[model samples]
Target: MNEIIPRYIYGFLNSGLLLIKYCRSCTVCSRLTRFPRYNDPKKLVETREGRCGEWANCFTLYCRAFGYESRLVAPYGVLTLILDFTDHVWTECYSQFLGRWMHLDPCEAIYDRPLLYEKGWNKKLNYAIAIAKDGVYDVTKRYTRKWHEVLSRRTMVTEPSLSSILTNITNETRRGFAPQLLSIIEARDIEENQQIERSLHSEDDESLSLPGRRSGNEQWRKSRSEIGSDNLSSSACPVRLCVDEHVTKIYNAFRPVLHQFIAEEVTKAEAVE
Candidate 1:
């Protein structure tokens, strides 16, 4: 239903298929944002273009404005070969379905697919944290394979030190709230942490599900690189570039699906595009 903002966020992502090319070009760098923040969804809606963080920030802002709770999440440590965890950002909105907050990546137009990185992309996950108005949340369990592997990353900060840091940051971030509510938020954070601890300790939660296909293959990675270069290859004749046959077909196939989803949602509200 339109009432669920996560769906709207997901739908908006699907509608804004601009993230596809953006990811290919800018995933390796944050510097691209400086050229233009792409921070305004209004502009992105009009232009139909933006990178991953732009998609995340815009979605976060839109969700908050539309009366839904939201947060921006980023992985904290270990973007190594084993972890293969890249520095990425996404929005998380409170979900009525799972009765807990869920992950929403606009870049991939994926909803509740934290495991997509570990399982689908066949990458490792370490520490991921969410920064929201109410409090800081450790949401790593939703993505990781080996809990023990993340222990060192978690140890980067002691419990007491991390608590103090989060408390101070929360006060600064959520200062507009009534002073009386700070303690309430703090209590909620503590409870959520305890819940996460129990959930992560469960035997079933230790390993992520494997991918059906052998993931992160060299050929697949190379194909993705070609996909990112806007399907055109740099040849000896720089001006005379050749387009990859597969990329055009794939993009054309996916483009219509993205447009249809966006159109359905737009019919319900004023559309920027």
Candidate 2:
């Protein structure tokens, strides 16, 4: 269901389908064009089209309906946009295969590309929060490699205060839930955060070479500074020699022990002689 839902949503929402932008009292309006953004899934089904906001909203609802644990991922603070309403929005469905939430953007028909916004589009993201059934999570770290830059941009609230706010919201949302369930959720959150840290620090060249935003027009993406740079070569990315480093560390740590063992063997030999 997780694999099928985004493609299912994307199947009908192609370029041919047009969103109603300008409709008059009983006819069509020509001068000004602005339509109320629909949040309800039922209304979205009727309209059959919208931007990222509507796409994410409907996709998340469908995922929940199909018994998949999912969440609507969106930015928390103010987003200064050249076009569109918010920075970007997408869905993250908990993947049984990986035992973690995977990014699923129906708009792009892209999955597991959490770095799309930051790396692909070349956008500076401040906060990316996941609004789940159990609670909300400040998942900004999962999406960006330049985490220090993202941190510097987060001037709206202090880290502790932001954490407090999210905790409060989550507690309120998780009210009446079993203590055991809450504990499980908290453990999952910690594990996920650790996983995100590992992923952000990953030295995978494939991740580093991910292309620019594939959904929007070239001009629009360029305007938003999202049209990511061309494929990065191995020379440019320079994969870290962690294996060599680890071996060297092990040798350094055990060198003294090896010398002591050799000295003990020689001393026993001298005594025997």
Off by over 4 Å in 2: 1-33, 77-86, 204-208, 229-273
lDDT per residue for candidate 1 within 1-273, as digits (tens), equals 001111111113433432112112233443222123334455554454444565577667556545567898877632221232235678888775565677777555567766666555544456677878666766787666457776665767786787688778766788788767867666666666775677566555335442222212235445433112122233453221222244246545655544554557643234223
The alpha-carbon deviation from the true structure for residue 40 of candidate 1, after best TM-score superposition, in angstroms, is 5.3
Q: Cα lDDT for residue 52, model 1? A: 50
Score every model by TM-score.
Answer: 0.54, 0.68
Error of 1 at 34 (Å): 11
Best by lDDT: 2
lDDT of each: 0.54, 0.67
Clashes by residue pair, model 2: 121-226
lDDT of 2 by residue, 87-177 (tens): 7888999988898999998666678988878767777789888888788888888888788899999998899999999999999999999
